[model samples]
Target: MWVLIFWVLVINFLSAQEKFTVKKIVFIGNEKTKKEVIARELSFGVGSQIDTSDLAYSENRVYGTGLFNRVKIWAERDSGDSSIVYVWVNERWYIWPFPILGWKDRDLKKMFYGAGLIHTNFRGRNEKLIFSFALGYDPWIEAEYLNPWVLGSKNLFYSVEVFYQRVKNRSKILEEEFGSFYERHLSFALTFGKRYGLYKRFWGSIGFKEISTTGEVPYMKTLSPSGRDQMFVFGGGFRYDTRDIPIYPSRGFLVSVGYKFNRLVNCDCFFLQGGLEFQGFKKIGIGLIASRFFILNSFGREIPVYSHFYFGYNERIRGYFNDVFEGENIFGGTVEYRIPFVKQKFFKWNKAPLEEFSILRFGVDLVLFGDFGNTWFNREKVLKLRYLSGCGVGINFILPYDLILSVGFARNDTGRGQFFIDFKGGFE
Candidate 1:
C-alpha cells in the first residue's frame, strides 16, 4: 500500500510540470467586443507553448481591460503534447442613456440635475462617446469622443471635447465680499496619446478657452481689462500603471507626472503648472492596503481663484471634512485598508426594466481610512506649516457600471466626527 501511494504522488508531480503547445484557441461570450481586442491582451498565441498555470495570467490580462465583469481561461489536454485553450468572458452592456441627480455634500441648495448618453465600447472597440447637458447651480452642455486605437493613426489614440457652461464661482472669499455670481466658459480641446505596451502611456494636448465673469472680482479673471480673457492651453503627461484591477486594485502601483501652460493668446496673464501623483496597493493577508499622495503647484503672475488649490472644495483632509483650506499650492495623502464584505459577482434579474440594467455586479467592502493634507503657503516656510488629518471607517458599495460610492465617518483635531459621502475612492 505504501508503494502504491508513492507511485501515485510521483505521477501527479510529473504531470504538474508538463508543458503543452497550443493547437488552437477558442473564445465565448464576447458578443460586443471584437476578437482582436480580446486577443491583443493574451499572453500566448495559437502556436505558443505554455504551462497549465500560465492560463491564470492570461485571465488577469483580459480582466484588466475593464470591459468584462467576469473572465475565465482554461486548457484541455489533447491526445498529443498539445492543448486547446478556451477563453470565456462576460461582456458589459455598452450603451446607457441615464439620468443624473446629485448634490454637492448632500446640500440641497447645491443640487444639480441632467441627462446623458454614454457609449463605453463605442463601435465595439473600447472607444467612448458622451453627450450630456445639465441645469441647476452650474449648468452646462458638453460632448466628448475618445478612440484608444484609431483605425489608421499608427496605433495612436485621440480625444476631442467641447463644452459651454455657466460656472458659479465656489470661492468663499468672493461670495463673502462681493456676493455670489456666475461665470461663462466656452472651451474646446484635443489630445493625442500613445501607449507603450500595456501599462504605460504618454500624451499631449492643446486647447482654447474663453472665460468671462459676471462680477469683476480679484483672483477671478485674467488681465484683459474686460473681465474676460481668451487663453491657449497646452499640456503633456506620462503615466505608468500596473494595477491588477483599476476599480479596486489589490496589487500594483501607478505613477503620473504632468505639466501645463495656460497663456492668454493676446495678453499677459499666464500660469505654468505641474503635478506629481503616486498610488500604490498591496495585499495583506485577506485584505488590501492602499495609499495615495499628490502635489500640485503653479507659477506665473497670479493664480486665479478658480485655479487655486483648496482642501475642502476640490480636496479634503478627513479631519477637516466640512472646512476649506486654500492656498498657492496644495498637497495631501490618504491611506486605506479594505476588507471584502461581499465578493463581486454577476446577478441576473430577468424582470428588470432595462436589459442593460438587468445583469448587475454588486459588491460591498468595509474600509478603514485616514487622510492628511494642507495648502502650501509661499510666505510660510514649508517645513513649519501644519497639516490637517483624520481617520475613520466606512462601507464601499461597488455598483454596476464600474461605479463606487462610500458612506463614511471621520474625525479631525476638533474631536468632532463628521459623516461624509465620497465616490471613486476620492483619490484625486
Candidate 2:
C-alpha cells in the first residue's frame, strides 16, 4: 500500500511539470466590455504555454484594469497537453448619470452639488468620458476623456480635459485668514503617455491657463503683475503602479516620479516642479495594511501662489480642514488598515441574461488609519515646519460597481475632531 501511494505521488508531481497549451479563452459577465478589450489585457492567449504562475498573473492584470469588481480564472483540461482557460468577472455599472453631492469644506453648511454623465467603457475600449457642472463654493464645469490604450496598443494612451471654474481662495473663505477672494479660471490640456514593462508610464502634456481675480485678494501685493494672467504651460511626468486594485488594493506597491515645467507664455515667469510618491500595500491574516509617502518640491522661477502644494483636502490628510497648510515643498504620508468582519455574497439575479453573468458580491469593512505631514517654503523654515498628526476609525461599505462609501471620525493635533464622509469609485 505504501509503494502504491508513493508511485501515485510521483506520477502527479511529474504531470504538474508538463506544459499545457491554451486551447481556448472564455469570458463570463463582461456584458458591455468588448471581447477584444478583455483579450488585450490578458498576458496569455490561445496556443500559448500556460502554467500556474501565468494564470495568477493574468487574473491580477485583468483586475488591475478596474473594469470589474471581481475576477476568477480557471482551466479545464482537454485531450492530452491542451486546456481551456475560463475567466469569470463581475462587471461594474458602466454608465453612470448621477448627481454629484459634496461639501465645499469640512463644514456641513457649505454644501456643493451638481449632476454629471460618466461612462467608463466608452465604446468598449476601456476609455472614460466625463462631463460635470458642479456649483456652490468653487463652481466649475468640466469635460474630460481618458484612453488607456490609444489605437489599441497597451503601450500608449492619451487624455484631453477642459474646464471653466470660479475657484474660491481658501484664505478668504476661512475669514480668519488674509487674501480671500474668487478667481475665474479657464484651462485646457492635452497629454500623451507611454507604458513600459508591466508597471511604468511616462507622459507629457501641453496646456493653456487663464486666471483673473474677482473681489479683493490682499495677497496679490507680492505678485509680479498679478491682476490677470494668461499663459501656455507644458510639462511631463512618469508613474509606476503595481497595485492589484488602485482604489482599494489588497496587496502591491506603487511609485510615481514626475516633473512639470510651466512657461508663462503671456507673462515673465517660468518655474519647474518635481514630485515623488511611494505607496505600499500588504495583507495580514484577514486585514490589509497600506501606506503612502510623497514629496513635492518647486524650483526654477517663482510661480503663482496657486501653483503651490496644499494639504488637508480630500484624501491627503483627514483630520484638518481644506488648505490647512500650504508651501513650496510638502511632505507627508498615511498608514491605514482595513479589516472585514463580514464578507458574504448577497443575492444574484437569475433572469434570462443575468444567468449568463457572474453573481454580485458585497461586504462590510472596518478601517483604522493615521496620517502625518508638514509643508515649508524653504530649507531654513524646515525646522519651524508645523507637523500635524491624526488618527481615525471608519466604516467601509463594499458594494457592486466598485463603489465604497466611508464615514470616519478623525482627531488631529489641534485637539479638534470631525466626522467625514468619503465616496470612492474604482476608476478614480
Candidate 3:
C-alpha cells in the first residue's frame, strides 16, 4: 500500500506541472476583422508558455469586444510539448441600415419611427459610425463617429457627435397647468479616451448645447434669465470591466466613476455632477444572478430641468412603470436571477446572400428580479421616501447584435401590478 501511494503522488505532481508553448494561433470565421484586432484582446501570444485554462480566458476577452456572435477556443498539442491555439468566432452583423419603430409608455398612439445606418466594425477595427433620425413624440437627428484606436496610436481613442432633438416637458405641474410644451436642444461634442489594458479605460469630453423651449420657458426649467440657454459641458470618467460577456455574463464585475459639469465656459447655467456605478454577476447552480447599484448627485447653485435625474425616464423601478420622479440626487439598485430556458445556440443559413446576416445566435432566459430606488432634491429629503421597491419576473429574448428584449409584470409597495417591456435585459 505504501509503494502504490508513492507512485500515485508522483503522477499527480507531474500532471500539475504540465505546460505547453504556443506554437501559433489560427482564427476561423473572422473574415472581416483584422488578425491584429483579435490578437489585441488575447492574454497570450505565439511563443508564450500557457496552461490549458488560458484558452478560456482568451476566448472570453475576444467575445467581450462585442465583435462576435459566438466564440469557441481550444488548443491542439504535439509530442514536442508545443501547441497550436485555435480561435473560432462567428462575427456579428456589423453594418445595419435598419428602420426604427418604437412606442413610448407602451402606447401605440405615442409612437416613433425613422431609419438609421450604422457600421459597428468600421474598417474592421471596432470603430463605430452612426447616422440616425426619429420623428413623432420626440424628434431627433444624430450623427456620430468613434475610433477606439485613434490614428493607430497606442491605446488612444476619440469620438465626435452632433445632435438635434425636440422633446416634450416632463414636469407634471407644468404640464397640467400649461397643457403640453416642448424643449428643443441642439448640441455637439468631442471626446477623447485612453484604454489601460483590456478591461480598464479613462475618457474626457467637451461639448456645447443650445437649449430653448416653446411658449415662454419657465425660470425653474431654465438656468438662464434670457429663457434661451447656451451652455458648455465637460465630463470625465474611468471604467473597469471584467464581465465574461459584454451583453450577458455569468461572472465578473464592472466599476464606473464619472463627473460632469455644465456652464464651464460662457454660460450662466451651473451644475457639477458625480456618479458611481457597480455591477456584479455570479453563478447560482444552473443559473446566474446579477446585481447593480448606482448613485448620482449634483452640486452647485442651479441645475436645468432638462438635466435633473428621473426614475421613469431612461432607468426605472419596474413596479412604477408610468410614474416619474424628478430630483437633484438619485440612487438605485437592482437584482435579478436569470435561468436559461433555451441556451444559446448558433446556426447558419447557407442559402442566404449576406453572410453578415446569415449567421445567427439565439437564446431565452426567464428572469426573476427586484428593484429599489429613491430620488430627492435636498439632504433633508434623502431616504425619507426610501420604501419604494418592486419585484417581478420577466422573459428575456436574447437576440443577435447583443440585444435583449425583456417583458415582465411587477408589483410595488402599493401592491399594484404593472406590466413592462424593457431593452437591455436588465443591464446595459
Candidate 4:
C-alpha cells in the first residue's frame, strides 16, 4: 500500500545519510520552555552518534509535549566526524485563562459552561496545572497537577487531583417509568508513575471517594444497602505511545490498560473494574488513517449504578448523544481518515509582541469516520446489546492555544442524524 511504500522510502533515505557524532545540541526560538527540559527529550546528546531516525523521534517527542506550534530539527555537518544538531521551536502560549462554554453531551441542548485557568507548562518544565469549575447539567469544581519528573528523577512521575461533582443521572428507562437520580460525589487521588524506556509508562494511585444520591432507582438498594456509600479506591495502569503528536497523530501506535478496585468504607459494597484501549495511525499519501478499539468491564459485586460503564458520551461515537447506554461492560471500535485541506500558513501579523511571537498560522483538516459498539450487563448477555454504528464527517480548525475546533454532521444506523460542535486537546 501507499503507506508501506512511504515508510520504505523513508527507511532508504535515512540509511543513506551518514551518521555523525553530535558535537553539540542547540535549541532556538523557545521563549518559555527551559532548554534543559528540551535536552532531556532528545535521543542523542553531545558525543553521541546522530542518526536521522533518532532526530525524527526527538522531534516528535518535543512536539508531543504540546508546547510548540512548530518544531524543526536538523543536523549540520561539522569538521571531521562531528555535527551540530539544531532544534528550533515556535513556542505556544502556555498559560490559558479562558472562558469555557461547551456541550455536556454532543447535543447542543445539554450545556455546561464555566471559566478556568490552565498552565500547560508550569515553570517551563512540562508540568501541568488546572483549576476549573463547570455548571449546568453536570457541575464540578476540580484541580489537578501533573509532573513527568518528581524530585528531579527522570523515571519518576506523579499526578494529583481533587474534585467535587454534582450530576443529574437521567435514565430513559427511569424517566419513562419512574424518576431520575442526582448524585453528589467528592473524590481525591494521588498517583505515582514510572517510565520504562521511551514509550511505556506504569502508574498507580490511591484515593477516597464518596457518593450520595438524592433519589433512589431500582438498583440503589443493591448499590448502597446500608444507605451510606463511601469507598477507599486503588488503581493502576500502563500506557505505551509512539504517536507523532498527541493532539492530532498522523502515525504510530498507542495502547493503555488499567484497573481499579473499590473497597467500601461504610458498606459491604465492593467491586473491580478495568479497561483497555488501543489506537493506531498510518499515513497514506496525503491522508492519515486512524483506528481505535476499547473495552470496559466490572467484576466482583455488581458495581453501583452510578459507576456503570456508559457510552455515547464524549468520544465514544460521533452520532450519539451523551450517556445513551449503560451496562457492566462495553466494547467498541472506530475508524477514521483525516487529511489537511489547508496545509500552508494562511496569514501573519507584524505587531509589537505579535511580531516576535506572532506567527498566526491557519489550517483545516477533513475527517471521515465510522464507529461500531455494543454493551453488556452480564456474561449471558454479553454482546446482547444491539450493535450501534455511526458515520460522520467533520471540519477541524487549527488555532492558537493548541485548540482544534470541530464541526461535524453524523448519522446513526437508526436513521437519526445530528450536527455537533466540539474541541480537541485536553486532559481527560
Best by TM-score: 3
For residues 295-360, write the lDDT of model 3, one tens digit per residue: 999888776677778887777888997688878888999888777899977777788677666777
By lDDT, who's the top model here?
3
Of candidates 3 and 1, the better by lDDT: 3
Write the number of the candidate with greater lDDT, choosing between 1 and 2.
1
List model 1 lDDT by residue over 1-428, tens digit each.
22233233332122365789999989998899987788867778988989865676668678778788677899998759888999998787778798978765434457889999999898788889999998886888999999988753366899999999898777676678888877789999999998777678899999999888886553345456667878999999999987666666656789999998999876777988889999998666456678899999888776666666777765777668668777778899988877789986778889987555567778888878778888875665889888788888889888876678888888876688898877755353
Candidate 2 residue-wise lDDT at 143: 98
For residue 291, what is the lDDT in candidate 2? 77
TM-score of each: 0.86, 0.81, 0.89, 0.86
Provide the lDDT at 401 for model 2.
50
Q: Lowest-lDDT window of 10 residues in candidate 4?
A: 6-15
lDDT of 1: 0.79
Off by over 4 Å in 3: 1-21, 47-53, 79-81, 104-110, 151-153, 264-267
- Backbone clash pairs for candidate 1 read none
lDDT for model 2: 0.73
For 1-428, candidate 4 gives per-residue lDDT tens digits of: 22343344332111366688999888998888889778767777899986787788788778778787667799998899888999998887788797878776555777888999999899999999999998886889999999987666568898999999987764455455657667788999999999876678999999999887775453452367654478999999999988766766656789999999999877666899999999898766566677889988889856676766667665456677444776778898877666778773524455736433465546788877777887677755664457888888888787754567778888888879887777742212
Off by over 4 Å in 1: 1-24, 42-66, 78-83, 104-109, 151-153, 217-220, 353-356, 426-428
Q: Rank the candidates by TM-score, best first.
A: 3, 1, 4, 2
